[model samples]
Target: MTTNAIVTTPAIQRLATARAAVVKAAAAAQAAHDAHSNLLVKLADAQARADESLSDFRSGKIDEATSALRKAIADADAKDLQKMINDSAENLAQLNDASNGAMLAEANAKVAELYEQRVEEGSRLEAIISEIESKLLDAVVERYRVQAEIDPDSLKWMKIYKPSPALDELVRRGRVPGF
Candidate 1:
């Protein structure tokens, strides 16, 4: 083979490898973005569910037995008794003594518990998504570093060959010949 062909072979191989790395990094970034989007959707859905549950509890739409069960469990494990009482049965009773205040309290407590759990889950998912985003960024930076290492001159060429937006528009409009 000619000297030019011999030299070009390794260059071509390096270019292909760099291109593949870029494609892989792009795919990974896209997947991470998709996961982040899904987590946002989940967070919204959890919030909506929490709101609906709270509304149902307040409106006496939840069953009495279920509400009582929830209250008993939550109250037994509660750290802030005054807050729990204020947020639960006592609060409801104060609002309307004739209403099923105890049941409503239990239901409200349960709704709050579920809402907190969902928020925690959303927080964990957000952290994971953040980690994935960081990893994607690192991967891209590493790929660029590797490419620069393999072909230092390419960076100089890129700096010199910056595209002109006006020229690009003219080319697209068939007013300038495109190369």
Candidate 2:
């Protein structure tokens, strides 16, 4: 009886090639997913920092405006203004406080607007990531379906063609050549 070395057929080569392509595509998709996830984390952190900065700015502006108004009122009292002037100065102080409040409110609204924009951007990124993941899954499934269509005997030969691990360590490491 004569024994011949097993030869790899064209179909087996194609299957192996397809599998490699699928693995590479999956790896690329994973990297992209990681990058998008990182972007989301960074965006959230930036939004938090921006919100804190806005709060600090509002607090500082209010404190400074209040301090200035108090100083003006004290100065007016020291001058012993006539009742009419005193009343006018009091009204002026009230107007200044109202103006400061209005400005602060505007700034707060602007911050809220900016926050909404960031949220929208984040949502867009998430949608893109989801789409990419779905496409990758489809590609993998299609590749597997194509592989399944190959003759079972040819598939078995392809499996046999894979290099066997010679060392126990290699086997323990789950290393398969051409995989």
**lDDT for 124 (candidate 1):** 100
What TM-score would candidate 1 get against the native? 0.32
Q: 171, model 2: CA deviation in Å?
A: 26
Error of 1 at 44 (Å): 1.2
Task: Put down candidate 2 lDDT per residue, 1-179, tens digits, no spaces.
Answer: 89998856444454455555555555555555555555445545544554544555567844655555555554454344344344555555555555555555555555665666688789999999789768966776665566668744444533433323553345578654455
In order of appearance, the predictions have TM-scores of 0.32, 0.38
Q: All candidates' lDDT scores?
A: 0.56, 0.56
**Can you tell me which runs of candidate 1 are displaced by over 4 Å?**
1-8, 63-179
Ten residues in sequence with the least summed lDDT for candidate 1: 91-100
**Residue 82, model 1: Cα distance from true site in angstroms:** 28
Each model's Cα RMSD: 27.1, 27.5
